[model samples]
Target: MATNSTPKKPAADAPAEETAETVTKSAPARPARKSAPGPDVVGPALPAGAEPISVTLAHHHTIDGTDYPPSAKLLVSPDYAQRLRAQGYATPA
Candidate 1:
C-alpha cells in the first residue's frame, strides 16, 4: 500500500459562504479626529443662535528660511469672519 500526499480538491457541489471580515478590506472605519481642548484660543463670537465651528490652519514655511508655528485650528463663525474682513483681512491682490 502507498500513501497519497496529494490534497483532495473541495467538492464542487458544496455551497460557499464568505465571512464578515473577508467581505470588507479588513480595515476598520476611520475615527473622528479631535483637537486638543484648551483655553489657548479665544472662542470667536457668533450671531445669535449661531454656533462656532472649527477650521484648520496650516503654517507656511517662507523661502527665506523663516517658519511659522503650527496651529491646529480656529474657532470661527460667520460673524467672526465678517469682522476679520472688516479689519481688511481680505485676500491680497
Candidate 2:
C-alpha cells in the first residue's frame, strides 16, 4: 500500500480563479451620466393660420417611437400644441 501526501498544484496553463464577489469588487464603478441637451428648434412665430408650430416640452414624451425630452422643442400641429399647452405638457417656443 502507498500514500500520497503532497498537495496537488494547479496547472501552469490554468487561468486564475475568481469568485463573483471578488470580480465585482475588483471592477471599477461607473458614474451616472447626464443626458445631452437636445437641439434648439425655436423659430419665429408662426403666421396666424392652421399649421405646425414649435413648442417647448414641459414633460417627457415618446411619440411614434421618438423620444421628446423635457425642454426640447418640437414642431406640432396647432391643435395638438393647444392641447399640450392646456395640459401643461408644453409651451409655445
Over 6-92, each residue of candidate 2 has an lDDT whose tens digit, in order, gives 999889999778878777666566655444334432223455775767788899865544566898777767767787889888964
- Tell how far residue 46 is off in model 1, in angstroms: 1.7
- For each candidate in turn, the TM-score is 0.29, 0.44
* Candidate 2 error regions (>4 Å): 1-49
Residues 1-93, candidate 1, lDDT per residue (tens digit)? 999999999999986898786687666776654434543333455668876655443442121232223444455675654553465432211
Error of 2 at 18 (Å): 38
How far off is residue 62 in model 2, in Å?
A: 1.2
Model 1 ranges off by over 4 Å: 1-43, 60-68, 81-93
Q: Model 1 misses residue 41 by how many Å?
A: 6.8
Candidate with maximal lDDT: 2
Model 1, clash count? 0
Q: Could you give the C-alpha RMSD of every candidate to the true structure, in order shown? A: 14.3, 9.3
TM-score of 2: 0.44
- Deviation of model 2 at 2, angstroms: 66
